[model samples]
Target: MNISPNGINIDEALEALAACTVWYPDYREAMRIITKCINTTRHRKDPSSAMLIGPTGVGKTRLCRMIEKDLGPTQQARNSECDKKTWPCVYIELPESATIRNLSVVMAQVLGGKPTDNQSVVILEDFIIQRLVTIEAKLVILDDFHHVAEKGLTKTKSSLCNWIIKLLNRSGVAFLISGSSSAEETIDLVEELSDRFPYRAKLQPLPMADKASTSVLLGVLASLEKEMIKLGHLKEYAHLTDPTPYKAIYLATRGNFRRLSDLLHDSFEIALLRGDYTLKISDFAEAAADLAFCCCPNYFLMSHSQLNFALKFQTNKSSETAKK
Candidate 1:
């Protein structure tokens, strides 16, 4: 692989892959919920919707798309009038300017029509329902439902939620609403919609095992170590995986996969350009200093390299003093 300014090109490639990978358990659960909702819509009379709540970059949107693709065309196979142009899976991002009127316009546009009437808002919503029925859409995923809250339009949020509930109760469209993990915040905004979805799933953060599970995270770091070794920066900073360095990395990232990935990516780039593999205590300190200056303080001020060197130096000085 051609090495870029950021140590190895593989870091970026690995980051991209890691971003898409849904780990093990979350993947299975997400697939199950989506399938259940779609199948329920097809075979049942009173269809209900689901809400997928989680933090940002926790694979919520990706899971939604994956489920939609697996359902295959989203409607009944027997509808001959249904053209491919009419997609069964309609994914809508809640806009910043969310009002009853604008939302109606958005829905109308999604259904391939223009909003042109005194009751255009009503007509747009009805069009969406009818089209969904026509396409036999088993699922309608509304990603970033929290945008309504962020936009400071609680009425619009309530209206949108009400509209969704109506679809679930009447139209048989299963909904999957994604949101953040703060329990209080989630409840405050989506409290009304919660009663409808009895099956609530939370995407828990990855566990950081002491020694056994540490390898899972370390393996990620090891990969970077190997790449940096190849680039000749390992000798100076090779202690990054040593006990001290390992603890430092763990403390700094707090087991957040996205932040961990970003830090490793940037650190490797810095190390490679500096042309040092054996990362010194000063190097880690310098990195930390730079971070603090940039207003991004690492949990620990002293880099592993700095700590290791300082300890070693102190030990030698103490031994010399004892001999004298």
Candidate 2:
């Protein structure tokens, strides 16, 4: 069994790789939007709300967690008096079958109270509003806001949106909604609801045709490589600067952050299992195959000869860089 020069074995490398965190430009943009929304809504009568719309695996939930962390203690309160505390933000996810009652129950629970099953929707709503006021919650983040539209609950979804709008107006707290593109449809069902969330931040996948997108992709790869080095992986992974592996990776994952991360993770695992100190282009090819990376034309049309050429080119580049 071959171990890394840094004394990290296969199991250790896999664990370290799985725990790596990579931040990108879009994540920063989302954080900015969240902070701006929270600050802008403070002490305002008509608190503004914003929607974060993106496809699945675009880091919407992760962005929300980042914002929550930056704001302050999410599960803790600032002051304690008679068991009441000031919560600056309340984060909750919409139930699978979203309704006013479900929303209220979740809100109340997060606000430090448990509602009984017999509690009416009206009572639950009152309790939620009162708690928000009591805690001075400046922001309310509802993740997976699109769930309201699931299970043929169009009417209920519209009603829930309106109800949330009313809560925003009444509590004067900004609501940051993170959900898929389908969430737009739910919000559109209500005219006033749509107007309330005029500001929308969208997270998009990397596009191969766009120069800026390619730059971002390279930056992400560079950051990941740096993190990998920090994890005691002394071997060079020069995929970021190498054009061959760079293009192949982009084509394989289509610039989706989660997919890209998974591809790199899987490749690292394969290399470790094969007793290789460095990642190879063939490792990436195998990982992409396991991940079903056949959506892009470049990947589908790629031949074995092309892959071999890329592997050889990347190897040569890595060796040249090592000598320098």
Considering every candidate listed, which one attains the maximal TM-score? 2
Tell me model 1's lDDT, rounded to 2 decimals.
0.59
What is candidate 2's lDDT per residue for 1-324, written digit by digit as tens? 547544567666667776565666677776777777776776455677888998877778777876776677734434455555677778898888767788788888887788999999878778888888887787789999878755456776777777887787777778888888888778778888887776688998765432544487777777787766555454755455466666777666767878877877877777666653576666776776767653333442366468556546756886899999
Global lDDT scores for all candidate models: 0.59, 0.72
Best by lDDT: 2
Candidate 1, 1-324: lDDT as tens digits: 646443546455444434444345565786677677666656765554566776675566777777667666633244466544436577776676666567667766776777675765656777777777766666777677666545545575566667666666656677666666532244345665666565555554444444744455565566656654654535545455666766666655544555555555556555555543454534444555455322244434665577456546645886899999
For all predicted structures, in order, the TM-scores are 0.64, 0.79
RMSD of each: 9.4, 8.1
Model 2 clash pairs are none
